[model samples]
Target: MRRFRARHNASARPGRSALTSEVGWFVVIGVASTVGQALLYWVMRHWSPPVLANLASLLVVTVLNTEANRRLTFRGSPVRAVQAHLAAGGLFVLAYVITSGAVLLFRHYRPTASPAAETLVLAPAFALVTVVRFIVLRLVVFRRRNR
Candidate 1:
């Protein structure tokens, strides 16, 4: 027992839990994905209807997000991946509602807002949503209890 304790203590490093690593990766991925989503939305808006562009960007990013989180954060199995996709469906809708509402409200209040301004407003808005997404992904969808 003493030997085991020594070994465990020796291996322990402060502020470096598995969860900390996962969160670090999650933040990295979230930043990259947010930029990608915003850029995709901006470019697509020029060629497609606003609603369609939103859907396309949301769908693409959500799928990519799920896969990335499954591998990097959750380290999920095949079944867990399927479950993550299902959970992502609900998350995607919730995120869309949150982001789209922000956009709509911004437009209503400032009808002449530039596209750049809209993106600036959305960056922080989506950053807040990203926190919620991480919580749901970690606690609910990828919880070990489910598998």
Candidate 2:
């Protein structure tokens, strides 16, 4: 048993370990993005269209997240990093669309609910989308190009 365990530990590649570490870094980036979005929302509360706030927040978060994910998370080759960043940005846009559609559907179904109430429910839905985004980034976009 001890020999098996030692062998298993020794067989783990540094590349695989880095991928795991990247997920941890991505979580931190997600939290930061959430905070940035909240701050943008608070600042833009007076705007007629609140979605503008979300867009602005998404822009800010995307740049920050891309930089952090490139440097700290995946640590892919320069070519791969650039490609992954672009792909991930596109995915984020798709996530936004999905999240917005879901929120609108919720509002339509629950017409009696206040905007705040609907937003509260939609927050977690967006969070779920974010998780999907991370998985795509990790598995598809930022996946290391095996040399």
Candidate 3:
């Protein structure tokens, strides 16, 4: 009985630890990506329309974020780099729609709002998208390589 219990506990540790590690790395990468995108958006907005700026910034950061997640967060995943980017492309479109819509809505309500205000509106949208991105990346994009 004691030996069986020890084996069971030991066997369970890897899955739990892998998940915890993935979550930790995902968050670290996500926050970095978020800051990067936000800064890019700020810089781009000075010349382009808000929606276009948002699109460009997201495009840049999405590529970077997917690669980071693949290398660090989902290390050992069997999915090839191209396939991961394909999946991440879909996620990028979703994020762009959500965030750009937030910007548009903010503008509609506050037409005189500054660039900072637009970014503020995007913050919650980014937060929501981050949670969804993690779930999809884990269950769909990476889908875990066989141990």
Candidate 3 local lDDT, 36-129, one digit each (tens): 8888888888888999999998899889999999999999988899999999888988999999999999999999988887887886787678
Off by over 4 Å in 3: 145-147
lDDT of 3 at 37: 85
Q: Write the per-residue lDDT of candidate 2 for residues 75-138, one digit (tens) a residue.
A: 6545465676688778769756765576567757886765455456546655676688788877
Better of 1 and 3 by TM-score: 3
Better of 2 and 3 by TM-score: 3
Instruction: Provide the TM-score for each candidate, comma-separated.
Output: 0.83, 0.74, 0.95
Give per-residue CA lDDT, model 1, range 1-147, as digits (tens).
Answer: 999998887778542576797798899889987887788777776676445766788789889988898998777444467878999899999878887777778878988876666666666767787889999887788765633
Worst 10 residues of 3 by lDDT: 119-128
Rank order (by TM-score, best first): 3, 1, 2
Model 3 steric clash pairs: none
The superposed Cα distance between candidate 2 and the true structure at residue 129, in angstroms, equals 2.2
* Better candidate by TM-score, 1 or 2: 1
**Count of backbone collisions within predicted model 2:** 0
lDDT of each: 0.78, 0.66, 0.90
| Most accurate candidate by TM-score | 3
